[model samples]
Target: MDTNVITPEGYAELQQELDTLWRHERPEVTRKVQWAASLGDRSENADYQYNKKRLREIDRRVRFLRNRLSKLRVVEYNPVQEGKAYFGAWVTLVDEDDQTLTFRIVGPDEIYGKQHYVSVHAPVVKACLGKAEGDEVRVRTPDSVKLWEIAEIRYGLAAADR
Candidate 1:
């Protein structure tokens, strides 16, 4: 559960977001705030208040993205990790009830908007780490312990292949 580890694609995505917020979005909000402020009425100006709040939010996100991008380590796929459940692995597991769940193991930051992604810090992912296809994994959650069989383990194409 190394919080600093992120897939190469995840890192690139974060970088792109930072670039967009800094280069495009922030400047637009700043201009809006200035234009709103120029309108005489300060107290009842809805545009000024709203755009000012948006400017603060954008600045906060830009600062956070800058800091997070600096500390993240982009983990590229390694040949040794092929066929094993590791970071950036697409894992499929079947439970005792025969229900199947599939997700890609990624960093905590990358799981926010992705339904098919699970954080490495999650209990299920922790149990599946280093396991191979057809291996049985015991996942202990706050509610109960469950058994899952690894049905498939796949990784994205290697960097060289791309």
Candidate 2:
């Protein structure tokens, strides 16, 4: 399987979530399952049935997270990537309608809960790769091709300053 790319912050967040699930949530749920089981007649026990299902779901998620984290490569900000659109770059673009959109190019895992974060594999990012400020890019959508101009590009501390 291909390794997934993740930002340093995103990597840490995943690790913390894995630790919490393994050390805290799993144990608490396991205790509930045990308590429910001790009441006997598990086939008719609502608590037992519920907890058993919940435990399976939790374990599945834990396994998936562990495997995903193991295969992820945490990408840190690089000064060498300055002035061009790349992973972890904050980019501003002007669309054909003359409207401006600003977003950060990040990994697939980092886009959750962040409206302004675009995945590196997204068509817009693919079109913008290796493009510097003032460069034009073409994005092909299902309906038509759209034109966008790179208004600005920055990385690391410089990106935060903007």
For each candidate, what is the lDDT? 0.89, 0.87
Measure candidate 1: CA RMSD.
3.2
Give each model's clash number.
0, 0
Q: Which ten residues in a row have the lowest lDDT in candidate 1?
A: 153-162
lDDT of 1 by residue, 39-123 (tens): 9896899999998998889889989999998999988999999989999998999998999999889999898977788899998
Model 2: lDDT of residue 19:
95
Off by over 4 Å in 1: 157-162
- Model 2: runs farther than 4 Å from truth? 1-3, 157-162
lDDT of 2 at 144: 95
lDDT of 2 by residue, 45-75 (tens): 9999998998998899899999999889988
Structural similarity to truth (TM-score) of each candidate: 0.92, 0.89
Worst 10 residues of 2 by lDDT: 153-162
